[model samples]
Target: MVSRTGLYPGTFDPLTNGHLDIISRALKLVDTLYIGVAINRDKGPLFSLEQRVEMVEAETKALSDGSNSVIKVVPFDTLLMSFAEELKADIIIRGLRAVADFEYEFQMVGMNSFLNDEIETVFLMADPHHQAIASKLVKEIARLKGDITSFVPADVASRLNEKFGN
Candidate 1:
């Protein structure tokens, strides 16, 4: 409760239900949450930046009904911590699902802390049901013509299928 604002940045090629869980949990811990949609061309995102932003907006519409419905979606070029600073956010909310993610996030947290000593990073473990769902895995499964209906929201799954020609 110390920090009222948080920045939650991610590729969100197409927002999934797992991402929804993280956003929902982070909402409880902060007054405002900035869901940053970073457009990294090097990543070769499945969806365009505008499409990703639209999906993120749709997925977060429920938050608009909350008392602190202060979630905003924005595009970022790079440097996540720099984006946080620009948003004047005091905390960065990260979603961690498995042990493998810990290593990468840990290093990033340390680097972000070094960049902005006053900014804090908080990691939220994904819900047990969604611990295995990730954007990469979802894409891989779609490419293989596997069912990922459970891994993402309905709209996202449809978009993924269409994008991958499944």
Candidate 2:
């Protein structure tokens, strides 16, 4: 049988629960899932490229356990389509948390389609529990010493606290 590869790209400055949820859900949809860690300097990530990649790998490692699909963590600093093409991805998975995000993502889908219509982009709405979780918001809450345990994984929460010396 042929296999489908899905690419889920994000900066993941600090991998959040929402991201993991998407990863878990995405695994069910593809034979291989590539967690594309993007090097977006404009976002001014708190974590380094290597750090983000390592965290993503560590966090996603367990998601593939007992599953036939493979999950690879890759770091990229180019156009999203270029990275997707390189991986020969059959689909690009994107997590949408709210209606506000749809407008922007809608435009992105169009632009990406123009670049490569063959590679499809799939949108997965964040689970109800994770609908409010955003990496940026998580970072802010952590910086203020708020309880971010619910929004991020234990390891990531620890790292965020350490970053703010909490």
Candidate 3:
């Protein structure tokens, strides 16, 4: 039997509960999951790539339940489909939080299909509890001294607090 691999790529500026939800759910569908931390120098991310990767690695380390699947956090600075092909990922997992996100993601799916016809894209609806949580919004709230403990994981909240000196 061949093992299936899935790629979940994103900025993950600060890993949020919503991101973790997608990761947890994606794990069930593949034999291996790679959380690709996109290195977009244009976005001016709040956290460094290394920091974001560390946070994701720290947070997802426990999800590797011997028999289930393994989760790897990696940094990539290239077209997502190219990265997917490099990893030999069978599916590209994306999380949709709202209709607004769909419009953009739908376009991306079409473009990626043109780039790699063999790789498939999978969309997972955000859990209701995490629907409103976004890394950008969380950063803004944290910047304004708002409590973002509920939106992200404990380790992520701590890192954000440290980053903002809050």
Best by lDDT: 2
lDDT of 1 by residue, 1-166 (tens): 3548899999997677889999998998888889999899999998999999999998788765664648899999969878888999988999999999999999998888889889999999999999988899899999999999998888888988998888
- Compute the lDDT of residue 10 as modeled in candidate 2: 93
Predicted structure 1: clash tally: 0
lDDT of 2 by residue, 50-160 (tens): 989989998888889857889999999999999999999999999999999999999999999999999999999999999999899999999999999999989988989
All-Cα superposition RMSD per candidate: 1.6, 0.7, 1.0
Ranking by TM-score: 2, 3, 1
| Residue 72 miss distance in model 2 (angstroms) | 0.1
Give me the overall lDDT of model 2.
Answer: 0.94
Clashes of each: 0, 0, 0
Residue pairs in steric clash, candidate 1? none
- The estimated TM-scores of all candidates read 0.94, 0.98, 0.97
Write candidate 3's Cα lDDT for 9-66 as tens digits.
Answer: 9999989999989999999999999999999999999999999899899988877764
Off by over 4 Å in 2: none
Error of 1 at 84 (Å): 0.8
